[model samples]
Target: MKGSRRAVVLGLVLTLAGCRKGKEEAPAPLPPTPAEAPAPGAPPSQQQALPPDMRRALSSIAPLVESVKAAVVNVEVRDAAPSHQDTPWNGEGPDSPFGEESPFGAPFDGPREDAPRQGLGSGFVVDARGLVLTNNHVVEGATRIRVQFPDGKEMDAKVLGRDPLTDVAVLKLQGDVKGLPVVRLGDSDAMRVGDWVVAIGNPFGLASSVSLGIVSAKARDIQAGPFDDFLQTDAAINPGNSGGPLFNLHGEVVGINTAIAGQGSGIGFAVPSSLVKELLPQLEKQGSVTRGWLGVAVQELTPDLGSALGVPTGKGAVVTEVNEGTPAAEAGLKPDDVIVSAGGHPIASGHALTRTIALEAPGSTLPLTLYREGKKQEVVVTLGTRPDLEGVASREPSPEQEESPQQRVGLSLSDMDSRLARAQGLPRAGALVTEVVPGSNAERAGLVPGMVVVEAAGETVRRASDLARVVRDAPPGDALLLRVAVPGGGRVLRALTVPKQ
Candidate 1:
């Protein structure tokens, strides 16, 4: 059965090739008495020829492919593999949620300790002066790097700059780097779904392989990084295709092929060219990117949450917590403020706000429109340099020595005294939740033990009675909005539905 299938597929390919050849304007003359040639004026066999309409639709993109193939190159790197002791797993098992491998390539096998690990990936020239663009993972921690063009010419290269957050890297070729072929970057924002695109790369070490497909989706968050706005494509991106170009029909590079779905075929992702364009200047000059910061944690305001907060649904991001001594706090931006716009751009979600802030320069003052307490207000804030969040750790709360009677909402609350405050790494105020009943309103609202209730119904809750009083005064079936101080340094809002007595 397999052999028969292969024969059928091979025959189809040859038929397509023949159709393409027949469409060419210039044709080679054939011998007058050639054998196996179809007679003139005779209808072509249905099994051997495609319909006219189908052949036209499959018109060759040879001219478009030829224009951009020269800029594409193969990237080779050699780095030392880490030993088991140096691995980040730290005794975690495969079932752990963070144990999944990166989608860019196959998982690294355990090699001999400090062994040289050789890798292959694809890249393209973006400037005539030998500047190349590729994925940061391609040459990360490499002891040696080489760039090989489609013509088999090799040149040593060095990392100009790299941004791991977006998985983009820029390289500079060594030696005489004059008049190199470059690809023109296109606007990824303009590429719509189902638009034709071509991919050129060295998949699996096969140099200069080409594949064709369309944009499958946009703005996909695959959890690859904090800034994970990837362009999903049906193009055949594989292990060695990382950092290659995804070109549009006009021969303009739209995206850099980055990763692929491990268990699925025809599902791949690329970094949009628009984002790469924004980083090119800094990557070339400063050798790194400096992102502006607004020290605040935010959450997406769903329709129900928006109606409860008296704001438009799906319009803005809700500020969950404002860090102390930060630009947000200095500008009087408080928790529960809905950010509707920033710097004249409308903020649609938390991710949008984050990306906007990160794109701005540090120390740049920007205007922000916010909805606070059902009143619209505008504030100007000076951005700060983003701080490293990797070192921030959440402390576990100690066991509570006393327990209160369960409330109607299924929460046992107590006052946050000095002992509990120090243990939980929180301030000495608010009502602390000692217990939460399973399958109850509080649990359904995400109320868990160790969470401190800072405010209830827009009022401060310094003790258990303060929270109970607000809950009691609320009408049945109404959601009691509560601001909670989580175990970490951030705060979150939860709405618990009042039970009918």
Candidate 2:
């Protein structure tokens, strides 16, 4: 029964992988140079050429490519996947920067009981001494990392440090290095939508391929991770393109290509260089990043909620439930408190608040502007270290987690209380599954018990009755959409084939 559900986890951020979008401009082609001039005596009409405008457009990106291609490198990693390793795996390598006790595991790939695998990605040299920047997802769990340059010179590299929260990793060449070719990082905040950009990376193991497009969007929040102010581009960034540098016309690296939207064609995301600027020193020194947390649950205020709450602006992050003894509770923050600003800056949404708080240093007191009970007030709260996604305030598992597994086709869902929800970092509303029957449809569909069912049949399933109703309403032999929290962490959508009654 456990094998029936297919769980797909898009990493660090959700990515869509496919062809290019129709609206995006294709890479500009280079015009024929004077060196390729038609044979000396060729007739004028026989000498074919593109129009002036086309030639000019095609030539704009070639100079930028020539300037930055030297810094781009292809990264390859070979590692064993959850099988036949001497040390009992806790989901990390021997030198994990997070240390042994970290709750984070070996990324959100499928079950580990498989064989060895090869990971392909990209990166760029950032300094003359051979410091390289790339996505953490590219090098994580790598047993050996090999860096290949434009001239096909491959060198051994060691992981210096990685900030998984931001999906950024830094590496260094094995020996002393100086005066090596490098790429300059630009201000990602200065880039606007429709701005021309180019990407140089190894896609599908093809080395040093170049693609160009405009910045399709910015500050995209895909919910792949917390620090998610991604710059979306139409550049052709495929699987092997992760960790590559997305360059601007000035030949500066503006973003680090990280993910391809798993649903869209030609849509890719990059980590802003501004954020990379902040993370460099910390990752270089501390080996991991520690972010500040507000200890409050909040969500964006919808129009209906705004009307009901009497909010004048009808915009801000609305407080959900303040946990006991947390900074929010201690600061007298209550449910329905609309956070309008932090340290004088306006808060746009819950995600904005999340990013703002995370940027602040822990243990520092920060001021918040809030609207409560139809009155504006100021509150000061001390920030705490950001909690692990799977480690919620170190709360113990709820007794509900210990309930005996039941059987419903293949799944046995149970009750979930606020305490368990907080402990598990789960949505407040969901039906918890305790078991999955072997050989059942749910099993075949990869639905494991202990995985929380947040939505089913395209609707919220907060209770057992909701699950039953959704199951009953489904047409026989068709598939039911279920968004479930897979065991160990990370959420995935599974298509559970409904067995005919």
Candidate 3:
């Protein structure tokens, strides 16, 4: 029994030894490398990495703002009248609303004391030698004009030229102004409606004020000028903000601040800079703007009018009247035909058609698209130089004609005839209303050229003389009510009050 027990103990001890050997045969862990170890006293914190593509885009447009800020300038104009100058419309005067009695009880007769009128506006240097760009309204009739730089340097500026029609003017500096920062011009034609833009101007005498906004709209016609293709924005432009630069994100001038919606909360407008580039050469050469003329009166195509004229929906201006011996007549473009496109650009409106045609150099052949009686056609017209009415014909009436009572309604009126109505594109024949003089009685009567008079003074006037006799027969009164039939079929009742004689 002792021998068997010793054998069992030996077996158990062998099993234990096998277990210990297995434990001792286990592999050891490898030592840590220096590269994998954390820094002496610091531990890793949570870190996020940006994408590679984002880093590249941020670097591209970072310099644009800085480059644009250097070029914009603030202009201040001061007009010092004579010390004895008459005070015009003083609100606190006896004739003013704030004064005693009716305030307006007395009429202003003579000039009173005068004070110097100071005006503030913005302008930008367009040339390195210090030629500045500003609105003509800024420095017009001002005795003294000064340009304030972004660096706060004030220099006296001289008006180089002023174009009131376009509201654009150039100012040249007399003093030393070398190395002036000039804004880079951008192609405004490439801008879209929603593109981001910046405006730098003086609003309410605040100099070098910068505002950012997107292009709210394009080709806005405020009717401020013939070439009024404005860029509308919500950039907080005010009265003194005129003649400022509207810049794109690329640090280039895309538009010029010209006008604003009256007392609006945010609506502002800028003239396109592309026009400045186009007119700058002509302004520099002749101190005036000269554009090509087709001598054709065109009308915009309305949906109903387009259908009646058999023109496509997207067609161009409709030639309502072609002047005799004009380039339009010479080009075989007749009345009622639509000008679809010009010079490879689609002509959508009468304004656009006129603008594109004006862009072409005088005597240059312009490729034009036309729609005639539902048929598509094309014509090449050689544009002609515009004629100057002031140089060719004087507007002053002869002294002998002064015996006639001057019409105070801002219009010169005559009775309409069927032939004249047809020439004016009237759908029906009626007594014609001719020329409206500026600030004349007929003008105040809301009478426009080419209007047919169906009734006047509660009587039907069949002839121009009959209408004139009615006006001559009526005693001076405050109002004249006339029921007129429109040529297009609708009957309109117009009430025109006579101006106090």
Candidate 4:
């Protein structure tokens, strides 16, 4: 009985699943009507569904892509290990820059013969004179560099100069070739998000590979460095795509493919070639690029900070610290001031401030509008050479730092040393409290990280051991007074009375 019931249920289920209604299928289709179509050789009705902007964009860009491909060349770099043990820096003997302890200081594994190691990149001829622009990282350490044309013809190239901070480099061929198809540079500032862009590069050793996509974003700060105004595009830039041209719809070079977001798809960044055009002349004229430096550490203005500074829109970069005797400080700039404008351009963020300052020529005077302590002040600052980038900043500490003590109250101290203070964006020389042990006397006294211990027991603290020595020689049962500058403000803290040992 159970088996029969199960069979009936299964049959019901199948019948329901496959059920078709009982219906008649008796109808004849009607013939075509003349009203629905144009009568007697008239033109058919036009459809208006296509977007006009898209059509215009496609029509304008089609020819430009092909034109751009003609000038974009593949770059091949060879980093051949020397036949003998070569130092890293000089590329010569063991005592070379790489040092004797360098892992790559040894020779190659195969026959002790010289072989040209190879790497592939992409670049476009910017001038008929054989001037090409590429990423600095592409050929910086290369031993031999070669540029290959679309016809498979190759020429040896020499580096004109390179700026690592911007990752821009210029290369020139040995001989000038006539009728060279040079790519015209476009204004990247005019680019808008979602605009179509094409990238041509040698991705994974595939030379002259073209990929298409739209500008995903603009002025993207990937936190690569100080000069990080990058154009983020999704045009399939990959490894070996570095140093290639990112072209706009008119076949104008807009950006240089410098980096791709790691381990990701459809995310890449390019350095705007407009910067290349701006900096190339300087690179060619001089051996290095010199940028204007403000010598102030700036912080982005958040909503709360803007409110505190009375900026309703939260615009501008706030000067958090100013280096003494530097351009900003010499111009009477101070901490707690907001840089609302530089060189007449509005300061939007820290990056914008850097970019604006960089655009100014070294030794030129730049007018800065600053908001300080509730008032707008204008100052003309003579720009200084970007010390670090140009290797102008004194790398060594001043003579005063050598006389500073080492230890203080379970904390390591150094002279609010020049190098340390400059690197840390501190204004004056004070005791730099390096480390305070957990549960140590200094830590218990509310001495936190980055505190410049200025005073101990009303005596000036010039070094780390100043605090330690003062505390050691202090009269028992007396509170230790410490003056330190916090991130937001400065305060004097009284350490709890400690019995002398």
Candidate 5:
């Protein structure tokens, strides 16, 4: 019995030993302590993101901010008449809503008052010898102008020139201003809509206030002036932000802060740097902006109208009228011609064409493509100086009038005869718009009751019948372009979409 038991135990031991030998032996049981002594201490409490690619490249704007802070400045001005100033600062008296909403317009002959009205805005140094750039209204009609640097050094500034047409101006520091930093200019045309931007300005006398945002839009027309293409940004620009530098991510000036919405939060407009580049030299050389003009009234094309013209909508401007002896007329451009492209760039709208011509140098030949009568043709026009932009119609609206039906668009019109025109202080011609029916085509086109409708369907409208006839002639589902004169000396082009049904 003892022998059998010993033999069984021995066989079991052999089996256990063979199994242990076949197994690869567990990793030597990790060590009794950490392999590298726990990294010497408690491992870093905080560490940067791993792999380097996980971090944003521009985490610090300090270096850029420091480099540009010197170029920006606070503009202070004193005006003789407080109430009558074209641009008042922030919210002032009853005129608060009107301040900074528009450019400093053509001056009126008014007596200068002794009331000392102090204003604050912003500007930037452009020349190392002390030349500065700012909005014209920032220093317009200033009894005295001063510039204060970020370093707290204040110097008197003299307006080198002013161009209210472009609302741009150049200034020279009257006193010693050495070692002032100048900011680099960037291509406004190259900036994308989502690109980051920064604004540095003096808001409400707070000098050098910085705000960050993105480019919200470009080529925005706020109806402030004839040349109203403005870059819109949501960069916290405020009342005193006018004439400040709008910087791109590259630390370059891409725009100049000019205006904020009369009723909005963060909605601000800046004159683009491309325009600044074009206007600066002219403003510095001549005290104004000299633009190339073609002497043609234009309106944007709609899809239905584009179909009628055989061109794509939003691709060009249609010639409503060409003034005799103007470059456009000289070039044989006729009414209804579609300017598809001009000056080597695609025309996006009437505003785009207007901007193209205005930017081209006077006397330069501009190559243009016109889609006429369902075919495309090319024309070359030697540009002419844009005459002083006309303010809205000189005629004012008088109260006396008779209403007649404009059935196509639901507008009430009146004949501008000698009796009615003289009564309303308007010319004895054209159709005066007396009423626009709510929710009608005319109303949808923004045809106000007091405006003067001078043109309809691209033809001069002389009487109620003229407008009615033009409206009646247009085929159903067609669009009509109306040139109306706003009461505030402004002209606007409106489109009435005639319903197909």
Candidate 6:
């Protein structure tokens, strides 16, 4: 009897599930009939009736999709048979910038290690002479590439240039390619959130699939790379949809579908066309990108740090470190200096400064406005080529230090001894923090036990006494600013409120 009851319940559940799926896939309602239309020559009312064709044209996006679908192409790539050392292509590997469980619509791979691996992606023609644009990852290790047009025509193609930094690649189709339909690149800067967008691609080898969605957000940093300003959307971008074009309502390519949150998440990312356009000329000419480098590490200038430094809060990037012999050091830029502007553009944040400098060519002299010792100063520095950071591992934080005797502002401090300095890979010229009292101002200020206080109240702290002296001399009820070297290699500013005696 129990088994019979269980079977009945299972059948009921399946019936309900089928009903929901049927409702979801049901066809849309038909257009209004002639009897439902307003009579001819009737007095005009607020609700004016329209012909069925006019209503369909107003309500449907079929025309727009038809107009732009021709330029979309399917990109198929085949890799040479894998060697004994190579792992089979499961869409997760060192070649992919996105790590395990990659956000990109990773190409579908064949299922064998020794077999030639085949992958499918999407691309669009941007020039009548058969120049095409797609994502670099789509064709990164392929030994052969072929582009399949909507009309079932396939043509061999070669990589003209590729910028791995931007994940963009340009391909030139071979064999009499004049008069190919092309899509116009649009101004991504003008695209606002919530604007409607259409994505066309071959998802899962289903050719010529179109999905409609709105721009969910913009300038999203998914930690994909240093220049991660992805346009987030709710479009259904799937595997095999990589390198597809994202079109605006005006039939212009605003972005390139590159990554997705996960399968069936309805969240995807696209590279803005603005950044693509900026890199296209260089990629076409040099086949690689060269970014300008200013050899200074900067951090955000918070309100309390700004108050202690006598600069406007949230206005500039604070120099944390100036590498030796670099452009910043050569220009005499010191730690604690606040960079307010660069190249005539206001520097609102550290990211802004980095992006502004990177956009300029190497060897270009850039004028900078900075605040040092509560005074404004101007300097010019020549930028250098940015170093390749690929494959460089980040330093992990140091282990917690042993507790010390001296305590202030809820911190136990000690002068950096030779042994401690060597262990932490730091110079012996700073006061080392050994412990942080829970709920204390120092702990609240983000002071960890392994940090070294390098500067306090704009004065160098070579020992704990130096920090104590600076704190003692500081005004009562004011925030004490300290520049601290973190356990790894970066510096950060902390503002601690002096405890009331």
By lDDT, who's the top model here?
1
Worst 10 residues of 6 by lDDT: 3-12
Clashes of each: 0, 20, 17, 3, 3, 0
lDDT of 2 by residue, 365-422 (tens): 9999988877889999988777776442232223233212122244566766777777
Give per-model CA RMSD.
24.5, 20.5, 30.6, 27.3, 28.6, 25.7
Query: What are the runs in model 5 whose C-alpha is more than 4 Å off?
Result: 1-58, 81-114, 312-314, 391-501
Tens digit per residue, CA lDDT, model 3, 233-338 = 8776665667888877667788877665443456677768898898877766666666688989998888888988887685479889999998898989888889
Clashing pairs in 4: 88-98, 89-97, 89-98
lDDT of each: 0.73, 0.69, 0.62, 0.65, 0.68, 0.71
Q: Which stretches of candidate 3 lie over 4 Å from their true place?
A: 1-65, 79-116, 388-501
Could you say which candidate leads in TM-score? 1
Please give, for residues 388-447, the per-residue lDDT of candidate 4 as tens digits.
743322321232332111112334566666665666666365677666544444567777
* Order by TM-score, highest first: 1, 5, 6, 2, 4, 3
CA displacement after TM-score superposition, residue 391 of candidate 5 (Å): 6.2
Winner on lDDT (4 vs 6): 6
Q: Give the TM-score of candidate 4.
A: 0.61
Please give each candidate's TM-score: 0.65, 0.61, 0.58, 0.61, 0.62, 0.62
Q: Is candidate 2 or candidate 6 better by TM-score?
A: 6
Q: Could you give candidate 1's per-residue lDDT for residues 350-437 as a string of tens digits?
A: 8889888988999999999988887889999999988755321111112232212243465778888888787768768898887776
Q: How does candidate 6 score on lDDT?
A: 0.71
Worst 10 residues of 3 by lDDT: 4-13
lDDT of 4 at 250: 65
